[model samples]
Target: MSPGPGAGSAPASLTATDKVSTFSSFRVRNYRIHFFGNAISNIGTWMQRIAQDWLVHELTGSAAAVGITLALQFLPMLLFGLYGGVLADRVDKRKLLIGTQAALGLTGLTLAALTFTDVVNVYHVYVLAFLVGLVTVVDNPARQTFVSDMVGPRLLRNAVSLNSANFQSARLIGPAVAGVMIAAVGGAWAFLANGLSFIAPIIGLLMMRTSELNPAERVPRGRGQLRDGLRYVGGRPDLLWMIVLVGFIGTFGYNFAIWLVAFTDQVFASGPGTFGLLNSLMAGGSVVGALLAARRGSNRTRFTVGAAAVFSSLLVVASAAPNFVVFAVLMPLIGLAGMTFQVTANSTIQISSDPAMRGRVISLFMMVFVGGTPIGGPLVGWLSDEFGARVGLISGGLVCLAAAVGVALILARIGGLRLRISLRAGSRGLALVPRDPEEVTAPAGAAIRPVA
Candidate 1:
């Protein structure tokens, strides 16, 4: 369970006793700029998401059609994600991100123009979504690893947690704003706003001080690097199982876009405002979970597995809620658990992998995390179409719950750890403790570092 090749040395400044700042990464001017720029961009991105899904749903009046839109958008990632990761490892990350970001913005603008002209169709939406996905194949991996370049290893976990907080915090606004704009002006305005929001991130990337960044050693042009990355991950049990677990949860459990629309239209018979409210409530929970993770400052497999279990279980319960209020009550808790699981898994993999292989590793992670939307979205849409939205949601939750249990058992067996549940008054309760206390402390993946 040793760290895979290129697990760079711990930052020299980090120590056991250093007080961890919840916003430590903000101390760095570079990360601060990156944070604020992405914040604005993320809001726009969420707004576009709301508008796009609503547009597709409105045009076709079928949940399956919305699923198809999501499928097309993510199909490129399934097809070319590994190659994107390889490219990310070779190129200047900052420069590559700027290009991808600009391309994404243009796609938004093109969609806006077509909609404004009154000639937009579902096919146009599908094509534009696919184009955005193509850019994201490169953008996601580059953006993920760039945090390392911005703040170095010392504040990586905190920075990563804050990044989630940033996205979710924007989620708190994006859907509400998009809902209002869609009701007042049109989806076209939302698209236009999204396209313009790209300017902020592009400017932020330009404003960065290159000298202060901690760039990884860029891999030179070569063949077989993709295979090499796959092999590297294959040889590590920790990385493999963690990625598998996330793949299941992300693909099956995280199709909120599809499910929310289905529920709003079919079950609740509500409009975009309710949909926006639902998303905002969940986002509020996500923002809280991410900030809590930032404060917690340590990653452990048990915590991740537990969070996944809680998240998936909540999904199951939510599907059975008797009314909108009951369903809405669960959204924030689901968001909290889901975000906790995500931030923990993401930071763990990022920190544990060799720096040289980070892009590929992260790409593989993103590939499964988002790329599976193509496969799951359509199927879930069909289920919602055939049976009911509740059935579709509950099925996905069951799959995720099963996957979490399976992964936990696999990791426990591999690590020779057993589940321990304490009933003592002062006990924190459930944990995974090594069967042989004398055995060498669990592998690097299971090791803990105090956040600083």
Candidate 2:
């Protein structure tokens, strides 16, 4: 018989001590190197994100221009995401990542040079954004699936949570620094800084011990592998439902850069510092949410649905704030709920996939999650431009709310779950529990098994 997945590598089962340590993944030397490297690179990525949007706005003074840039940036994913995943399955992930990282860094430097030379224009922004998206199409899936290789099956969830923490922690710093650079010196420095940050990951990947990784089964040269990936997802109700919910929410509800910039300019009448500060606040909340997911050690489809519902509702609340302070207060709350939804949904999809098809599966997941931005980003940008930020915010939130509700209802029927409510001692609680007693518990983080 063929060796099982993760054979000759770390097992999925955890030791008692492993369970106690929330940062179990950190114990792995490879992952520790990757974690720090990713943290530095991610900070640079965040800075570029802020500077890019700001640059677009500065050039055109049109929110719609920012939206168009956002739309263009993700268009390559919609076009080539699945193909990238196919390559990831067939190619050496580490080498592919090194190439993509180098390309991305060069792209950053190209934009920085144009800006610093004072010749950057709206067309330049559009072209460069599209180019970056092309690189991201390959990089996103490879980077995502590579986590399993570094930590094996044992600390996959913990590692995923820690990755989010590292990314968000960077967000906590990157935007603030970007804002200061934009305000005090200039936006060109932010772009230049991001270009250099890619060095950290390049060094990390070079230093890693290749003998230690748990390599996934490579797909043989064959036809119909793409169809195989589609069929794999099509057959799973849990994965299907989760993807549908996130598709709606992510497309409409997560246009933060566009809206936050609008809010800063129109509502607050403030500068880049306020805009960056708000993003940093949301990142702070994301860091908190990520740490909570790590410590709680829970991963279920229900958490994905429940968090989406709460997060969308909070977005609606955020839209109605009377001033920047009230709006700022709501950002952290939104960030918490958003991170809960994102991290849990990500884990659900990754854990549910077969090892052989993990890269293709993750690519599909990201295509829907981020690729839909092209459709939503421009439209939402248009809405904000014409109707103002409050209306745009409310509309996006309501659509997200509707999507979450739809998922819960569909899952309840398929899983034979029932809603239960209790009011005692002046306390109230609500639950969606399996109708069968045996369904109350299972392996930790098991996807809720839907009845056929």
Candidate 3:
């Protein structure tokens, strides 16, 4: 059914043709187009990522070298993410996306040319990867804030969850496709496909009707906008804590993909086919986790904290798996927990932020979640090189566990909830001690609130 001449065109309204009832965010025609385009493009992106890492490993046979490649790819994100956020605020996101995507497509084509011509080396791959990462520094913030412009606050949670679902679904397919392509047509073909894939997003960006977008008050670029953004985030304890926890997880624990590549290649002596399978398995689980999150209404603090804890525990389990089959089976659990944690964190931050400052807050979130990859990749790579990939995986899991525990305790203290563990009927629950129990007012016949 066609939308009645701007009848179903509100930023927060469901369109006439949306299939998913629960995910009302897709009702927006522009976001639906954006989502589908991103889904296709992300598949190619993941294909390139897998092929790139494999190519680097094939050339140098060093985990540290792979880490260096990852660092080069992400270093721009660490340095310029805040500036990118400022840019997002100052410019039209739709236009910014077009420019970034075009640049990224050119970079992919360049790599494809090098690979197809048999002139590609590790150095060339590193340089191209760094260039692509630079584009992403701007692209990530623009894309994130763009979702709000598409759907507004009402369905933002659902939109974020659906975005994760799209990403994970691509994750499940892209590597497998890349693996087949690599074996048959070679890595160059995968790169070419990635370059071509950018066309979908470019088309989506062009197709969007600009007048329908929710326009935030554009803050003019001037003195201290960066500082103001920082201060705004710092003042909100919830947002601050959320970003910090995500950073800790991203830096120390959430980088299983890179570690998984090394573990499969070096430890298990598995080929790209096996590596692709592991990634697909994890992505399959992530798809499930993301859909479940989409169904759940709103993001809560406890959900964020609990998901992190569960994610860390699953990582420990995945790290201890004895063989490739066991590890593959554990991949889904790891992906489920990890995606849930991330979706919860992303949604909470988006919903809590003011519209005018949403770009900066979302950029900070991206910085912590993605920018930390440069530092963590190198550290994990060094660990894999020195102590073995298993040690790198295990150490990362432990760090995640420690961070989750520490953050939980800190939040509990700040929220004035005394943390106590009690086993009731073979299940554990947290007991709360309110700071002023007598002063705590409750509606008549209401039960006491339980601490998470």
RMSD of 1: 4.4
Where does model 2 exceed 4 Å of error? Answer: 1-8, 11-17, 420-429, 433-448
* Distance from true location, Cα of 110 in model 3, Å: 0.5
lDDT tens per residue, model 2, 158-269: 7888899999999999999999999888888888888899999988998887777777877777898888888777777788788888789878988998899889887788
- Candidate 1 vs candidate 2: which has greater lDDT? 1
Ranking by TM-score: 2, 1, 3
Ten residues in a row with the worst lDDT in model 3? Answer: 1-10
Task: Write down the TM-score of every candidate.
Answer: 0.92, 0.93, 0.92
Local accuracy by lDDT, each model:
0.90, 0.85, 0.83
> Which candidate, 1 or 2, would have the higher TM-score against the true structure?
2
Top-TM-score candidate index: 2
Q: Write the per-residue lDDT of candidate 3 for residues 1-452, one digit (tens) a residue.
A: 22123322346455435433356777788889999999889999999988988889888988888888888888888889898999998888899999999999999899999999998999999899889889998999998888877876667788889999999999999999998888888999989989999999999999998767775667776899889999888777667777889998988776766788888977789888988888899999999999999888765687788899898887777777888889889889888989999998998888778876888898899888888888898899998888888888888888888888888766665565666677777655866555655544433543223324
Q: Which order, best to worst by lDDT?
A: 1, 2, 3
TM-score for predicted model 2 compared with the true structure: 0.93
The superposed Cα distance between candidate 3 and the true structure at residue 211, in angstroms, equals: 1.8
Which residue pairs overlap in candidate 1's backbone? 6-354, 7-354
